[model samples]
Target: GQTPLAAGIAFAQKYNGTGEVTVCYLGDGAVNQGAFHESLNLAALWKLPVIYVIENNEYAMGTHQSRSSAGYPLVKRADGYDMAGITANGNDIDDVREKMWDAVQLARTESLPSLVEVKTYRYRGHSMSDPGNYRTKEEIAERKKESEPISLFKERLYKEKALTEKEYEEIEKEAVMEAEDAIAFAESSPEPEVATVFEDIFAPEDHCPGRPDRGVSSSDRKLAMAVLTMREALNQALSEEMERDERVILMGEEVAEYQGAYKVSSGLLQKFGAKRVLDTPISESGFSGLGVGAAMQGLRPVVEFMTWSFSMVAYDQIVNNAGAIRYMSGGQYSIPIVFRGSSGAGLQVGATHSHTPENWYANVPALTVITPAFPDDAKGLLKSAIRSNNPVCFIENEKLYGFKDEVPEGELLTTIGKARIRREGSQVTLIANSASTHVALASALQLEADGISAEVIDLRTIKPLDIPAILGSVAKTNRVVIVEENKPFAGWGAQVAFEIQNRSFDDLDAPIERVTGLDVPQPYARVLEQAVMPSAERVTEAAKKTLS
Candidate 1:
């Protein structure tokens, strides 16, 4: 996974004019991964200063390279990209150093990518558990005598009159003593306490506490309001953040010159220039990993996927790298990056293009998941997400891009874990977020026409849910209905329902009901798509059922 990050690390070096080169090492087996090719192509195309070293150790675990790889010389693969390729004998220390120095010079001076394959052999099994039964002992002894790195280096030193047999023996004795001292220290150290296991799982919360008023003050009433669409509001947030912080950068496929696939980044490239606003190739894994590396190197990056559905290709980078890096590195690094793009199923883009992944992303620990329903919330929450210390998944709805609302004229930053009470009632509580919040509001209107009064709560953030607000609503209404675009099985609503049951089960007048999308792939046909998604009518019915 880290192999895909070299391009991004090198990109930061180039962006900051650091004049540094990144050297990324990989096994021969790693070349088969899609991320490897995607990263290499991106590094080559961008002319990022990076050297990819492929250590072809003859065997990948138990299988020989001949059984797995297709090509004879792995170094030649770099020629396909019109990049420099070099090969060296890994067993010879001088040869390896001289070849690598050439690659390093090419990268630092030319700012170009190169592939250097070092042909080597492993003496021991892949791990200590396995015996060396794959090859004969004779073959192993022959390699040790003819091509062992340390032995060959010692012979070279002897021929050059740089060392004697006595000095070599003394160095070996010192090495053994150092290893023994390290083992002794480990054996004498006490075991870690059980409480330490929970430490460093996440960085301390850096953002301000959740403001119950949603950053709206009495003084803000005097401020002028502008009617803007969701797309415009989001664009304003990105522009403001980039201007405020020089470290902020925006990158994605078609985000620069093409002005975003949905026009969310219409004029940013011209304003920020190509250095701050970059357009990348259609390689999600490569660019996503690059964003993570840049964030690790102290740059604030906003990585836009063409759509959240396309982010599936970069799940390893998002989940394993971005989400887990803080814990894995023991809180030594902060991944302050935002992954934002349109999501949901209203468009006729078919099942492959439509995915409501809020539930899937929220399941991961150490990730902030936000789904804003209106233009104002979109602007405010996005600004906060850009400033957050944790990795954030900002899920937007394509259908709601053009929906207009009143956004404040000045700076507005909303808290990440707060919910807004859209409407007030006592008969039943209707909870929803993102596109479903509109459905819930419509359902509330319909319920009001009848005798039943319904309260609408728009959950602006999914993870770190505002449970206090929800419990207060549930206690007042004594009945609850959750509405969401996610499918019914193990959906986001299910988690909300569980929390309500666990915390306020005694206040319930009837069983809690959920209005969710049907458990099926979204269809391309307009009629079928509408049928598969959660509708206002379905939400109304669920609210009525909860009251009954």
Candidate 2:
């Protein structure tokens, strides 16, 4: 609830360009949540043009503020983050208006976040079902008499002669009539069609799937054969895209000053300036949500999660908000944001730091999931993801970042949800993506030595499944073995296996086999980690088994 509110503030601060100030109003209860502090800290740290207003009505759903909060004068909490803090008399409209205007102006001009606490008292119980049992009626009546906001505003307006008593009565009558009209309209409104609920899951007319035709001339070998590492390829793509679009921005922990945790964004900050290439604080949900908001407001944001392990912390913002916002808004908004980072295990980082969450991301409807295997794909697919009109989870492998290969030069873009035939053969099709594609490629060589002609397919994009490419490969081979680093249970390979079985069951010569990671947390030991991951040896064996 309040998390969305904070997310809205963070989004607006980063994305809103109309010079219109964004103010997020939250109840006293919201301040106790971790997201509240996380958002405030990020807002202050980033110096975002945001105003956070806390409605300190003193009760967090029947629990008194004194019981829940540790300190008095709630505005003082802003001091901890070195943010500007002020208290306003909520009962007086002049005080409220003046404080809000000051905070908004400060945020807009200085790009500084401020906290404005409006001290007020609730006139009624927390909800309709509850009675006035928590506090005395005398106390409630006394506070209402002393600090009623509407009464105070009316009194001031009357004293200033802004309206005559007759005009005030007419205004009150007009308000009542408008409220009655709204209620009448609601009651008379027709029920929505059942099909309407499913119409807005993604932007209409944006879900076509086909292999990319990046205009690479077959005769131009020089442009198509420039060797680069995955890091270099990604950097080049980011640079080209940022140069092409003024609204494209990069933000994440260590993305600016440190040039990305993996150095993939090393030269971007210097090239784009600190404003576009932002180095955000270690608040994944805050920044990710901020990116979502910015995307909604017409900016293309590339948010790097140092790893998907850290992105798990921002799952709510990513899945619930980013994935669903377009559908929830009935296709009125398209979230053109990319959440990318190094993913997978192999660096002895233990279970927490290493996880292939491609399956998790792919599970969400309307999300475009990409796991590029090599340098060319890393560059091309990332460029496509940046240009995509949907939220994309671009999964990059840290293990493959250093590996080098020739990538096409000049402007190149790959299609999302397309699979590439890496190595062609006749016997069995081995499907993989990201780091596991290397294993499949290696296994293909081994299979050749064993006299088994294995066709290897790199599933560049995971979400759309590229069923046509896979079916085409399956039709040729009649046998299949999928390789992936994700665990055996509910893994991406499992989905592929199911689809292959359903779509190409008659084409199959054997049951679909899968070479996947062991169903356990990635271990810390080098040998053990290797054991849990899919390997060339395992994939080779699985390919042979499919033939046997």
Candidate 3:
């Protein structure tokens, strides 16, 4: 998981003009992972200053390297990427240092990545429980006698007359005493309180109460409103942030040169230059992990995927690395990164390309999930996400990118974790987000003609759900209808419905109804796509059912 992060760290070093080199270490087994290959490819393609050290200890757990690996010499793997490959005798500390020095120099001076295969052997079993059943005891003893690191180094020092035997003995005794003292200190320490289990899950900045100022001055509001598409609005936000902060960068497939897959990053590369606006290869795991690493280095990286469906390839980087780094690091690191891309159904891109993963990301604890419905919300929420100290998953809708609306002049930043009431009523509350918000508004109009007033609530942010706003609306309407474009089972709507029933069960006059995408893969056919996704008619029927 941390393998790809090295490439990202190296990228930040280059971007910041630090001329620093990052050295990453991985076991022999980790080289077989997809992320390893992706990271190396990206590092080589970008000529990042990094060195990947693969410690080939001859075995992955109980399995021998000969059986697990196909290649003759592990160092040859570097040839695939045209990277420098070298091998070192790990048993000799001097030899290992000499080989690594060359790799480090290549990275620092030439700005190139190198693969160093350190051939080593572990005499003991893989773990404490293992009984050395994989190999014979005689083989282990023979290897230890020939190349034990500590004994070999001591012998070398003795031959050079650098140390006496008495000195070596004293050093060993001191190390043993230090280890015992550390153990005694740990034994004397008190157990942590049960209440501390939830401590340090997120940075203090993430827990900051209330959203940033979303109010525009009365004089600025008098200026003419700009009618821009969602793509233009998002582009403006990215440009503004990059101009405000030099640490902010945007990278993705087609984000530069080609502008954007949806023209969202138009004119950014030309304006910010290639250093800040990067066009990455189609390796989501690599670039996403790189973004995580960059964020760890204090650079605010906004990584874009061609589509949300493609983000599944980089799920480990997003969910594991970016989502848990702050908590796992005991709050020492803050992953202030934003992952933004198009999502939801309506693109008719088939099952592989169409995916609404707001619920998937919202389930993560340290992630801020935002699904913007209108262009203004997309621009404002995206700006807020960029400034957030926590990782944010900004889900956009391809269907709404071209939809134009009035955006106030001057700085516009919407408050996250706050829902916007699109329409107010008393009959029932229609809760939705992203594209579904438009459907809910249309359904509200249809219900109005039938004498049923429906309140439309656009939940701009999925996580940190505005429960207070939801309860307030439910208290007035006494009925609820949740609308979303996700699949039926355990979808975003399901969580919203559960929250409403759990908190306002007695306030509801009728059972809560949900209108969600059908439980099936998105189809390529236009009619099937329409039938599979939530529509205005479906939302209207669900709202009517709640009223009934």
- Who wins the TM-score comparison? 1
Q: Candidate 2: what lDDT?
A: 0.85
**Candidate rank order under TM-score:** 1, 3, 2
Q: Kindly list the per-residue Cα lDDT of model 2 for residues 198-297, writing each as its tens digit.
A: 7878764353332345321122244557889999999999999999987789989899989998999989998999878988878787788878877887
TM-score of 1: 0.96
The 0-to-1 C-alpha lDDT of every candidate, in the order given, reads 0.89, 0.85, 0.88
lDDT of 3 by residue, 189-267 (tens): 9998999878777665642323343321111335468988988899988998899899999999999999999999999
Q: In candidate 2, residue 228 scores what lDDT?
A: 94
Error of 3 at 444 (Å): 0.5
In model 1, the runs with Cα more than 4 Å from the true position are 205-212, 215-223
lDDT of 2 at 485: 91
In angstroms, the error of model 3 at 492 is 2.2
The deviation in Å at residue 4 for candidate 3 is 1.2
**Which candidate do you rate higher for lDDT, 1 or 3?**
1
- Misplaced by over 4 Å in model 3 are 206-224
Q: Write the per-residue lDDT of candidate 1 for residues 1-548, one digit (tens) a residue.
A: 77667888898898898999999999898887889888888888889999999998887788888888898798888977889999999999989999999999999999999999999888888898877778888988898888899999998999999999999999999999999999999999999898988776566666674344672222133447999999999999999999999999999999999999999999999999999999999989999999998888778899999999999999999999999988888889888899999899987999988999998899898889999999988999999999887899999998999999888888888888888888888999999999999999999899999988998899989997989989999999999999989889988899999999999989999999988888999999999999989898998888877766
